[model samples]
Target: MERVNVVYVLLYDHSEERILMVKNKGMDSSYYTLPGGAVEIGETLEDAAIREVIEETGLSVELDGVLAVSEAFLEQRGHHAIFFTFRGKVVGGKINIMYPEEIEEVTWMNAEEALKYASLSTEGNELVNRNSTIPYVLRGKVIHKN
Candidate 1:
């Protein structure tokens, strides 16, 4: 199976009440997620987070710290994905969808509303809620059935 490394940035506005999110077009439907994407070869995780946020949301951010490290197996896809979520602060740029083909919209949503609509597991939602400066790990397994 292929191993994929992805980075996501959780950016909040000045008030910290709202978070920057992207509505992405999935294979079957659309879903809400934090601004981020796959890490390219030779790129560090932190650089990938900053670059992804800029590419997906048209905003530049300085990551404050790592938030969570999540792992999952995509059985159907024959892949294992490791996701690194970082807490970031916007330093400049306005909200815009640079990659229209993959992203549907870029907007800020209240924390509660974001968690409600986000395509994340219950534990994932809780991790976001914690907002801990110390990083946490969430491991998940894929179940295969006959």
Candidate 2:
């Protein structure tokens, strides 16, 4: 069985009413999502989150807390992917799109605008709504009932 485990950072700067987001091109892309990606082999979850942020957005961030965990099996892709979303605080570094193929744009979107993006995943909404980590499994297009 194929599987992909990843981390997503939700770095909220409430003072600016902004959230760090990344836009990816192509069909496989999630469009606009938090700054994060797949976890490297042998990498810890928190480390993956921190590393992904820098790799994708060129910003150094520290994990504030865990926000949510979502697991979904993409039958079409023939793999199971687990997403670990965390609350992150920018510590240093400038923002830029380091990976052009994977990241098209990086911006501090207004909190409302970020949430309003059409591509915002269901799991993403749940994370912001509760303002905390939620672990849930999604089987295909529908969320799996616990």
Candidate 3:
């Protein structure tokens, strides 16, 4: 199976009340998710997160630290992905959809509101809400084994 590395950035506004998120255009339907994408060859995890956030949301950010690590195995797709979610703060740029093909919208929402859109956002919000420094880990689960 192919192994993929993905990076997501959970950026909070100045008040630390809202999180930056993106609506991704998928094959079946659009879904809300943190600003992120696959890590390219020769790129560090931090760089990938920063680049992805900029590409998807048109914002520059400085990552405070890693928030969570998640993994998933897709047997039918013949791949597994390791996701690195980071806590970040916006430093520059405005909110804009830089890439319209993959991303449908960019917006900020409070943790409670964001929970209705994406489940993964829950982990990040929990850490921020509780002021926890430990990173959460999500073990990989295989849908089917051949």
Clashes by residue pair, model 3: none
Q: What TM-score quantifies how close candidate 1 is to the native fold?
A: 0.83
96 Cα displacement, candidate 3 (Å): 1.8
The number of the candidate with the highest lDDT is 1
The per-model lDDT (C-alpha) reads 0.84, 0.78, 0.81
Report how far residue 146 has shifted in candidate 2, in Å.
34
Better of 1 and 2 by TM-score: 1
Question: Please, what are the lDDT tens digits per residue for candidate 2 over residues 93-115?
Answer: 99877889888899889888887
TM-score of each: 0.83, 0.77, 0.82
lDDT of 1 by residue, 92-132 (tens): 99988888999999989998888676545687677667876
Q: Which pairs of residues clash in candidate 1, taking residues 3 or more apart in a chain or in different chains?
A: none
Residue 125, candidate 3: Cα error in Å is 4.4
Candidate 2 lDDT score relative to the true structure: 0.78
Candidate 3 TM-score to native: 0.82
